[model samples]
Target: MSKEEQAMKGLWDMFKKRMWLDSFRMKESLMAYNPSEIHCIAYIGEDMDSNVTKLAESFDMTRGAISKLTKKLINKGLIESYQRADNKKEVYFKLTSQGKKIYNIHEDIHREFKDRDQPFFNQVTEEQLDVILDFANKYNTHLDAEIMKLGIKMRSDNL
Candidate 1:
């Protein structure tokens, strides 16, 4: 095979492995929340009292799916629902104490995964990190444009 092809294959393999490791970590540690749920919770934690529609757009999920999932989260006491202060008709979701607990667990799982995978980048230098970051941003931009063409949502910034 050509050197370029070999490099591409290696990158694909690394991405696949990363995804698999993340799935495994979620499965092993997150007893109550699925990956999607945990992702939603994390987003809410990041942007407190965000409306369901915004959350749906951010995650590339349907509004109905976001609503159903948020309802389940509310029932589990992991999130609380409230009316938006600026717009009374718009309902927002926020993480409760129980939600914070689950978020902390998710953080721990992420940390453990990072620690275990440290060897993969143990020798990477700042210059290499910059190159990787630039590549990632460009790739994400291309992907975002393609997704937008398909009528999917697009972020304000590509990366």
Candidate 2:
């Protein structure tokens, strides 16, 4: 293999492993739920007043599962649900005070890790950081477009 190919493979491997480890660490910190569920909680906590249906779609989960999870959160006093002003059938959810506290705890945990790593990254030159940031954004855009196309093709095939 070419040197470039080997470098790309090493980068991909490191990225994948880091993502897995991060997920595991996040879940360990949250204690009660897995990474995906905690992600849903964090997103909902931040979004404020998003409905179960919208969240389910965002997480690619079934409405029933979202409903169940919402109920669990409500029972834990982490979230509250109410009917939307425009539509009685639409239920909106927002984090309770306790939920916000938990969210803050999660945020602090992440900030601690980020701060710890910041000094290490500070050695990277400004030009290098700019190039890396630009390339990351470009790659994300390209990947998103390709994923959307694949999703559409898959849906058409299913039909």
- Superposed by TM-score, candidate 1 places the C-alpha of residue 43 at a distance from the truth, in angstroms, of 1.1
Name model 2 segments beyond 4 Å from true: 60-65, 148-159
Q: Which run of 10 residues does model 1 get worst, by summed lDDT? A: 150-159
For candidate 1, the TM-score is 0.80
Candidate 1 lDDT over residue span 10-68, tens digit each: 99999999889788878887866787789989999889658888898888777888999
Q: Which stretches of candidate 1 lie over 4 Å from their true place?
A: 84-86, 119-122, 143-159
Question: TM-score of every model?
Answer: 0.80, 0.73
- lDDT value for candidate 2? 0.77
